[model samples]
Target: MVKPANKPQRLSLSSLKADFSSAVSRRRLVYLLCTFFVIYALCYQWQFLVSLGLGPDNIHHMTVGLIPAVGAVVLSLALYWRHLCIASVVPTALIAVSWIVTGPYLSYITLIQQNTVYLNNMYDIYVGLYLFAILFCLNMAARQFLNRKISAAIMTAVQFAAFFIIALQWVYFALYHSCITTSGALLIFQTGPAETLEYFHSLGVGRIVFIALFVALLIGGLLFANYTQKTLPRTPVYRKILPLLSLLIIFPSVGALGEEIFPQAFPIRTFIDTHDYMERSALYAENHDGKFAALQAVQLNPSESPNTVVVVIGESETRTLMHAFNPNHVENTPWLTSMKEDSDFTLFSNAYSCVWYTVPVLERALTEANFYNNKEFNSSISILDMAKKAGYKTYWFSNQGSIGVADTPITLVAKTADVSEWVDQELKQSTMDGALLQFLQRVDPNEKNFVVLHLMGSHIEYRNRYPKEFQVFNDGTVNQQADFDNTVLYTDWVLSQIFEYAKENLNLDAMIYFSDHGSDPDKGRQPDDISFKVLRIPMFCYLSEGYQARNPEVVEAVKQNKDKFFTNDLAYEFVCGILNMQSPNYDPTYSIASLQWKMERKDLVTRFGKVSLLEDTEF
Candidate 1:
């Protein structure tokens, strides 16, 4: 087709790409990018600062966000005035050292409190430096593409908006992580417009005013960041060093990549995963819905006076590290060790945790589920169901978390009981397990009951597990073994208290105590790992005089099978054998207490796979 000469030529839209190069220089871009990270880190982590300042003792205080953010700001300011670098290397050195101590390296104190090896302190500094370098490089690289004044203003505005939202989210979570959790989210999730407005109304005018001011401060900070940039001279060495910094970034980029691939380790991703667990928990709830009621309909006969069963579930405990089990010369668990000598106590020397993770392990352990076949895990009748059907008042009092994690499979099973009570509704490690004892004292002793006490036993960041008084083992050293021992001691105390409470107040007959899984004290950074320590848990049964008279044979058999290999996944059946409850799901073959029990020969099972504790192979 012939085109008219008067007609304009068509412009290709594909060729159009906005350029901000004239406004933003490589150095200025680097400065701005660096500022963005520093500011965001500050806003997100300011809540943690209150903790770092409080020292190692008050470790529950969140400080990671605040320390690094402040450090970055100092560094950014130092680099801003080119003269600050030219003035003297000494001041720069001082400033750099300050950051290493208080910023990313603040993990130093945190690791010390965890009782980790001294090597972890060096590793902490290296990680902190690497992180600082990564952010430093990023700020520089973004500025490499420059733009005009208007373009720069537009870019700054965009960055400000993005950071503002992020700042708000961090601020909200600062308050949230301190207390708010899945239940609160679910409450907000289920609330309608009227309810939402009522929630705001409940915050009241004074609180509302404070919230408004808090928001305003965040906006003001953004403006201040822009001002800081304007004060700096554009003349810079950023472009020349960009390649070196970028090359340095490659090492830390692996962290970014890992965060992308395994986001659960990252904060935002962790929040999402925690929330996702709730969603999965909801599905778990749905799958098991009405199944408990169905189990009750089965018309199972209860043994005469089943008495009381207190299934005390422990967390992150290693039997090998325990004095009652191995001692390792750390008498951290003196009371438990003493209790083990009592004739009433029957210890399961070879008890293995069903899995490493909390939710997965609890689901399998409590339900009629096996490691290989998990179908019935979500659908089958639980021990709580068996308890309820047998005409006993079932109560679940968990130190872990009660309300927010209702959808979690473990919580779901807890809810299956007649009454589920959580001592720590916030679900943060901030609360000590001793609070569980208070809830125990409240349970009605007159009723025929079954209670499950989910303890936060020696989970990591060991210092937080106990109060100041429990710091009996090497209180002044960065000895993780000591800290771990103290936690075990603390756990020993907690278990003792529960046992005493059961004996004193409630209709105490038989008590079964076991851990969900063990933890590698040396490696966990908020407690995550799997090894022999992660699987081996101290499980034991304590029978009162009346129970021994009624079921002497079962008690005797339990003692005999202490050396036999067994996974805690079969704990429900074991309890059934002790209680003498009959149900389709109750297999005497799996219970160590039952004479018909068949030992899980050779391999000890776990949530991931099986490992023989006897063999010197990798767990």
Candidate 2:
């Protein structure tokens, strides 16, 4: 038999109040707390820049930056007024997109303000814009799909979750981006509103601030829940102001479409446009299909075939800090100094990076004259392609990320090479010399090979970028001198090691090395920091003793033309002097190693759409 069950009495108001007071809903408090905190922090920090008065140049960015905060506040208020507790996905999606699209330009503020800022070349600007837009779209989609919450508990949990993830990201960026204030500011700004909380963390005050904000949000959330229970109508004040909010959003959209969207989406034919060149020129170059009326290359045939010629394309390696290139710097390059003493090596003292950035110069330098056209050539004709056509084994080894997983120029360059190797994925980490070892092991001593090594060289995140074990300077933090010399020394050591391995294992003939472009380490100057150290890089053609002994004329020619050769002239002179091919446009005056040649044309655009031959004397 079953016993009859007795029902318990309903709880009293007193008991309910006691329970609520003892255990406040931690989750509900977090969202309301964080929401106001972010709003207050952004306005407070950016007040100085706001006071200076933003202008036409940055009006678009300022608009982009301001809208998200305004939207968030409006949406939150609307939900509260409607007696609603949860936010819909649509408003969240709008917030995410607005936040991300504005991401690329976040750094523009600091870039304009920084004294040491280097203006991105015209080509770099276009590339960066395209890249940033695509990345923003992808990130927005991911965030939209990933963050879903229909409950107050879940939304509060999201606040805490987002805070920690963003904090971790900022910490890594700060450490890597140490001392480079402009770069650091840009990085933090892109990471979004939450990073201000983390910036306070870096200052050791984040915990107290976060906790105080957390408590405030709890009180706000409780008040919101209580108000929603009453089913209160939205105040008339909001209804009257709705027209203003609508206008604010619609006006910006219309203006953006007119100013930026239309021209970028549909450009008319122009004789010279950098964006057009980036989009279509690669195709024209590959097929030799463009009106390339401006340039040509002459080929050089070797008297005796050599086993291998290796070219190292170093990144951000500048002469300003290199002792071998500038006497004022301390002796930081013992290996390079010794290499310079060797009779077979020809060093050019006056070499400069034609462009301030990497990819444009990389495309221009390696692609010969064809790189400067406006056709849609997704595939490129690099030196590796030419070498492969000439029946030599061509290889490309790089430490740079494959800008895209598929259909990117870097990948195309790799595929065109007979053998291509890219070491880093997600561009996690790399060094110049480490990327080179990929090729050294595979090359056969008996085969004729042409290998190009693209190094990370002295790229930013200057301190952790190089291995700590390899660090020679004890300044405890990174400076231009220590960071650069450490990187240079590491690169020098790697080159020396590679050279030794080649000497022992292969019948190597020559090695040519140069940087894609140099760096302006002085933090507050423009790109043309006239100090020779910034523009200068070491360019050397080192011939093996056996090769020099076997082919003295080639060695003598290099010595004679060392001073006159520009990187632009290298492809034409090299192809004519070593490969022995002839094109109708080939002219030795411009193609040869001697600095005596002049670029005959002046008005034609370079592949990057910059006016080439601005002055004949520039070469």
Candidate 3:
């Protein structure tokens, strides 16, 4: 025994090599590399992921990133590593492509705008992993019925289709500086062939060439992968059934959670929403006559004197940033600031929008429907309807889109006017709000008129909302707040132009201006992350000498209520009071121009009546 122990076996070079090789085989090494690449590529847009608390500052990044990676690695280790590795490529590539296309905008939203709502959720990464698993299952399922050639072709087609959607989103963002939304998708149906061609032409040759090259590269890569990759052996029956079950049941169940958890599916979700919106619009249009028939019975007692009333709707103009509203801010609204001293002007200090978004806010503001009234929006009579019934020549001049697919809910109200005009007929052009002046000039203001001018004021992509001449806040550099300030300045100039024109050219009796909604450019206007700045809109009324003389009590009432809490949903009633058009539906309690008008800070609710402004401490 002693003699045997003297020759104790040592680890030889061959045995050591075998042990090391067992620990990390070539396949396992490749798998590890693939997993690393995916995690790295996904997190390359650091601001997006980091905002979700999945960065170096925390351990969330490691936990979240490793879960999906470990899951994929384990599946590969248990099954065919080659098949799993190949399947992972498609989703990884798609993620990379999506990041490349949307990275700048995501960065802008998170870093520049300080809005983390766009891509800051950890659910985004989960969505990507779910998509990866789906692609893997699809690959496995395709192998069961189709030959290698057919399966490869199908997979490549799927890849191409997903890539096409990404390309379309890129094109949309390039044109609008925003992603394709449900409203935006509906806008495509509203576009004619000429407008579509014009849009593409506007993209110019450089962008067109770049898009073509991108498509070519994508096709070439997919083709190379299809031709060069070897087919895996047929799996057992249970494996085939498992993939089918995952594809048909598990993947769809996860996808059904909707866009909040899976924003990567926005394209498909947008299309579905657009379809539903179109259907609703069509139904509303078909029932338009019946919906308004009740308005015919409601008589409007008009004033004896001929008058002109102007309603100017501003977009995303937050009083928190306007000098006229916030004295501590920059003097961006010089005209409004100057108007503050005018006896004719009455600036409302505590005005809030009914909702934080344009469409919903405008829907309530333009119609008799309101949060407290519990009136159905579709059945509610619009200001245009009231004006028309009162024998006033109503006109709607908007710089925004008119019709999309069918008449949008807003467009339905606009169409009720005797004359409706839009600056951008195609809905793709980024014309200045000043373009609306031409339409104003065409109006015969000598007649008793009810005019509504919809300005594209202070919307997103604030830089595009104004010309270079209005870029007074910036010094040839990118500054989101500066750009927004410039928009505010341009909007002030626009308001002055409109007021001067109406005063000089038209028999302007009374003018009212209020924004459909406000915005928190730093935090975004999403309902989930709303702030008081996103609801605190600027509102004011201008009375002509003629109007003040005829309606002295109304003017006094408006001036007295300037500091009272007001919501734009009561705009319909207020406009009626200004017009001196009395009707059974008119409620003096809600009209800011009436002495009976009353609202308390605690009673005010915004964000479509979900959040109380008084409780929103963020103000």
Candidate 1 structure quality by residue, lDDT tens digits, 1-619? 9886887766655433223443345666677568656654543343243232222322322234334434443444445334333222232222223333332233233223332111112222223333344433333343444433433344346444434423443444445532223354455456799987887798789878987887677545433442333222344455555345465444544464354322321122324545666676687678766675455333233336535679998887888878777855577778778887898888777778766767667777787786645546667778887777767889888766443332267777787677777654522223578877777765777778888888777765576678789888875544266777788888888888888878887868889988888876555543343566677888888988888787767877888898888888888788788777766667787788887887665655564555555652532
lDDT of 3 by residue, 1-619 (tens): 4564566789999999998888768768776677666654554454343442222222344355546533543343334454555544654457533634353343234233322112333433444445455555565566655677787778778767745656777777667656654457778877899998998798889988998898898877775665455555665643564555545534453553353445434455446556666676677566657756665433334455666778999988999899999999988999999999999999999889887787777778888889989887777878887777777899998876554332267777887788887765523334688888887777786678889998878876566578789988974434257777898999999999989998887778789999988866565434577667778999999998878887778888998899988889888888877776666667878888888887777887877787776775654
Between candidates 2 and 3, the lDDT winner: 3
lDDT of 2 by residue, 61-162 (tens): 344544444344433333333233343332233333333222222223323333121111112122222322222222222222333222333433443332
In angstroms, how far off is 156's CA in candidate 1? 4.8
Evaluation by lDDT, superior candidate among 1 and 2: 1
TM-score of each: 0.69, 0.56, 0.71
- Which candidate number maximizes lDDT? 3
lDDT of 1: 0.60
Candidate 2, superposed: residue stretches over 4 Å from native: 1-235, 246-306, 370-381, 404-410, 425-432, 474-480, 524-534, 549-551, 565-586, 592-619
- The superposed Cα distance between candidate 2 and the true structure at residue 157, in angstroms, equals 21
> CA lDDT, every prediction?
0.60, 0.49, 0.69
Q: Candidate 1's error at 127, in angstroms?
A: 13
Ranking by TM-score: 3, 1, 2
RMSD of each: 13.2, 17.5, 7.7
